[model samples]
Target: MIEKTISGQDALPNISDAERIFAELLTGLAAAQPGFPLAQLKTFVDQEFAQIKHVLHGISLLGQCPDSINAALICRGEKMSIAIMAGVLEARGHNVTVIDPVEKLLAVGHYLESTVDIAESTRRIAASRIPADHMVLMAGFTAGNEKGELVVLGRNGSDYSAAVLAACLRADCCEIWTDVDGVYTCDPRQVPDARLLKSMSYQEAMELSYFGAKVLHPRTITPIAQFQIPCLIKNTGNPQAPGTLIGASRDEDELPVKGISNLNNMAMFSVSGPGMKGMVGMAARVFAAMSRARISVVLITQSSSEYSISFCVPQSDCVRAERAMQEEFYLELKKAYWSRWR
Candidate 1:
């Protein structure tokens, strides 16, 4: 909706879609408890809405959504959702404590797309703001950046947040509740015969997620794995199902390949020529260029003859990768000693 408004495709609605949905949530909660403090809950909603509107108005005036403003908007949305959940739990007579990741729980490295700065975040977590007894409700994706400004972990960050929290709190296990029953040999929607995996090693889960398993976020395993914390992937809709558990144990008698996964929208780049054969530091130089451009290489392969090296990156990074390689291998290309292909 914010994107649509910025593009002049829609009127900025009277309230954000989130606010409207949260208002309906408030109404439902009130309906369940006639004596609930509806006014108080509405006030919380109003405050959150005001902040969102303020950010939206800024976007309108600027005619662009800057990274900082976008991050702020994400933080506000997560905050509102957590607040509503807290209100609902409170209405049911539960002692709920809302913990804002931006304020306390997480510390991230970048403005919009970010990685958790585990050292700093773990330091903050050690300070221990989480209440021992209250039912804690946390903003899933928002975190504080190095500037103490609001930022977010990249897509599927909530699962990363859960793993970080579980690791920091020294929990025995981390459970990721999602729509599917558990991780499968392949995405069940695409492969009807995809088998549900009951358990997997941490390395196996990491590989599966990195290769495009949608059930677990790619980075979610890092923290938990580092702490030796087992992670359970379960279906929220079918809690009784024996979900997939990711841990240290490995089954030697199991199939060599436990799962099959694939990444889509990838572009492969190849550098080949007689110049590359037996060329010392040639592959290193090629990858250093990608690192400088901040392009993540997904996979790499080299020929036995050592005449060529090829790597894959997301399709979106194709242009940048091409430019980086061109600049890095300018002399080789100019002299006709090396060739490039995509």
Candidate 2:
């Protein structure tokens, strides 16, 4: 082992000649700054210069690729972002294709020697900027169209876009990397004891989406759900950590309901009627009336062949829906009864 002198503590174990070199890098960095944030300092080390088991490991850690990868990342127009993204994936030895502005689809297609697929981006870009295995989709942006910039999928579009691209590629599963480990009964940032769900069905994710789960977009599941593509939500922050899987994995001894996702602005409606028993199309009529008024329903539950039924809707539309329901389904309303609005 090479000899090295240090002024501070020997915190790192299994010191090696190469490791000592890396260790000296830290000292050199420290010599430049006596007071540096632990987090930021560590980030510089882990990000810029860390010992690698393999060259590929170094590439993966750098988030770059040697040739190319099968996956594609859609993001809004930002040359710096693209450059940085390319750098990271390139380090990981992945060939990343950056597609921007919806307009680039055709060009990317023509150049790649492939045809554009609308339902999903499944074109072979043999001559394109990206590789043949790469895909197409909108980039992640809040909302709106940017000129010359690739389409922003909007809100949770990246997640949806990745799923769709994965579908086009027919990948076994799509793993979403985020800051948190996985889905919990409540936001882990909020509830410390928020239980993590091992697995969740599409319906459950849908319910959560309706209740404003930031993890997924509502439109995402329907397409993939058509093909039943399972998604794993993993924490980009902690790679080795176990994340939650969203699929049809039902645990026999698990909670009948894995998690409870609640929408904040909700209005409850209670519709009751003895005459409504075995109601022919009363349920349908209630919804139809609300539809006419453009009122949205959130949750609903009814008794079996009974006179009473209850549902929830947007709090803002409660009065309008209630009035509509009361006016249309009045006869059934009198015998049984209806109350509770918002």
Candidate 3:
């Protein structure tokens, strides 16, 4: 029997839902068969335990900031999810300060009780007084928009939060740790031969992510690129491996196309009529209708003759877009001024 050593970090309340589901699965298997591949199950559980330990160890190492650099950390999710990260940093003899970004900036005012004054959160992070050697961990969520309303950055808002923090603080670099080593030329799950990119330009990364690469959020690049900060994507389980780096520029590589990505469930629409030829407001009316319908146009093209316009949007929005156009051009449709292409 192998003896295992455990610490408080080992019991962190992260991924509890996952643990519950796993437990239920094992329970069901055990109930069905008294001896149902217990060895395989045990091996899987052990691997999970080891992965957790590795994560905690890697986080602790991050606390050892180099003399030349000052570090700030941003974490997403509830406080319980981040406790282990904070606890481990403090255990390593580093002063750890936990802050809520909403408290610092008026743009993202307090949600329930308190009020946030008119202050920019990015400015606050840049001007923080915490010692260079100390560490600050921010629990991040949605931020405020220009209207002072809470705006969630979507499911991957955490990545946006980290980039904002790094850009504000002018950190040397920003790193994101995930399950995979780095960004691949294509999704490895679909293309087993997909190659990992050691480094890529910000433009390439942005296009890939926007087109459908899931490694990074589309918004994650905005702040980092605005400040020209290099961002790295690394594996939490295998910290030793060099992951992908995204920067303003990289050495020219032989590959002209970085990777292939795509989006599904999309539809194209074409609006055409002789009345649209040389008409200035025709395109505007069409787009206005789409805007009013809250349908996002993905791609757009117009014929050189100005007699027709074509655009692509999410397939789910096809009906909405069509309805909006019909209402906006009811008179034109009734008079045969224009017709919608199927």
Identify the leading candidate in terms of lDDT: 1
lDDT of 2 by residue, 13-111 (tens): 433353456455545645554442334434543443233223334344455533211011122123223444444454455656665424333212111
Write down the TM-score for model 1.
0.90
Candidate 3 lDDT over 1-342, as tens digits, reads: 001112224334444555566556655655655445445554565456455545545555564422111111112223333444564455456687766564454433223212222226656755667687778786554454445444444447677777877876778999988899999999999999999899998999999998879899767887788889999999999999899999998648638888998877888888788988787777677778888786767778899988888888899998988888779988878988775556
For model 1, which pairs clash?
Answer: none
Candidate lDDT (C-alpha), each? 0.80, 0.56, 0.67
Ranked by lDDT from best down, the candidates are 1, 3, 2
Q: At residue 157, give the lDDT of candidate 3.
A: 62
Clashing pairs in 3: none
Question: Which candidate has the top score in TM-score?
Answer: 1
Local accuracy of candidate 1 as per-residue lDDT tens digits, 1-342: 568658765444646566678788878888987556778879977987787777777777777898887877766666766766776677778888766577565565567767776766777766766667877667777778767788888788889888887876788889999998998989888899998887899999999989888888768999998999999999999999999999987567667789999899999998787878788887688789999998888898899999888999999999999999989988888998875555
